[model samples]
Target: MTVPTAVLLARDDVTIRRFAERDADVRRWTELDRGGAYLALEAPELLAADVRAFFGPLASA
Candidate 1:
């Protein structure tokens, strides 16, 4: 079960663990709003910042 467009990782284990705990809720929310999912749950700029924050190190390295 993977969201191809979603890169959800954190620099620390705790953050990853916490986010992992909410995986089910996110999935349910996505399912509940199929139309929103199709259109993207967040705006492009917000999503770019989030992905950059999560994968900054990888990108720089």
Candidate 2:
């Protein structure tokens, strides 16, 4: 079985993840929703901040 990279990266468990401010409005933003999956969520700003904090090193590198 071969799973696509997009599938591997797409967030599955929402329990530990959320959407970013600039991306929260995206319909099925994740690869998991590729087939016309749409969704909306609140508090996207926090998610964005958290993402920055977590991946800041990569950007600087």
Candidate 3:
């Protein structure tokens, strides 16, 4: 699924950012290592860290 970043940026009511799983494939396998689409299930702590990083500043606002 492609995000319309240009269209989204043209809107004034939203803030957006993109996170790319560069090593992940459609089936969620990592190209260079053992990882799957079930990241939250496989790596809860890592997922939590990324989520916190994304929203942490907003919480402080």
Candidate 4:
């Protein structure tokens, strides 16, 4: 089957990492598949918020 249609709606790496480091499947997390869950939550506004959340801090950094 083809890859599922999903987007971060968000793509903040640190956030994604934090999430994965949390209750996520630590050992096999995204090994066989990429961050499909992140991909699955796609929405235009959320993606924008994610971008802003990341870049806002990055802009200062």
Best by TM-score: 3
| 1-61: candidate 4 lDDT, tens digit per residue | 2322122322343345555445443322222122334543544454555456545754575
What RMSD, rounded to one decimal, does every model reach?
A: 10.8, 12.5, 13.8, 12.5
Estimate candidate 4's alpha-carbon lDDT, on a 0 to 1 scale: 0.40
Candidate 2 wrong stretches, greater than 4 Å = 1-40
* Per-residue alpha-carbon lDDT of candidate 3 for residues 1-61, written as tens digits (9 for 90 to 100): 4321111121122322323323222222112132345655666665565556555655676
Q: 1-61, model 1: which lDDT tens digit per residue?
A: 3542333432221234346545633321111211233223544454456566555655665
User: What TM value does model 4 have?
Assistant: 0.33
Clashes of 3: 0
* Residue 11 displacement in candidate 2 (angstroms): 17
Best by lDDT: 4
Task: State TM-scores per candidate.
Answer: 0.32, 0.31, 0.41, 0.33
Predicted structure 2, TM vs. truth:
0.31
Q: If ranked by lDDT, best first, what sequence of candidates would result?
A: 4, 1, 3, 2
Positional deviation of residue 12's Cα in model 4 after best superposition, in angstroms: 17
lDDT of each: 0.39, 0.34, 0.37, 0.40
State which candidate, 3 or 4, has the greater lDDT: 4
Q: Which stretches of candidate 3 lie over 4 Å from their true place?
A: 1-34
Shift of residue 11 alpha carbon in model 3, Å: 31
| Ranking, TM-score, top scorer first | 3, 4, 1, 2
Which of candidates 1 and 2 is the stronger one according to TM-score? Answer: 1
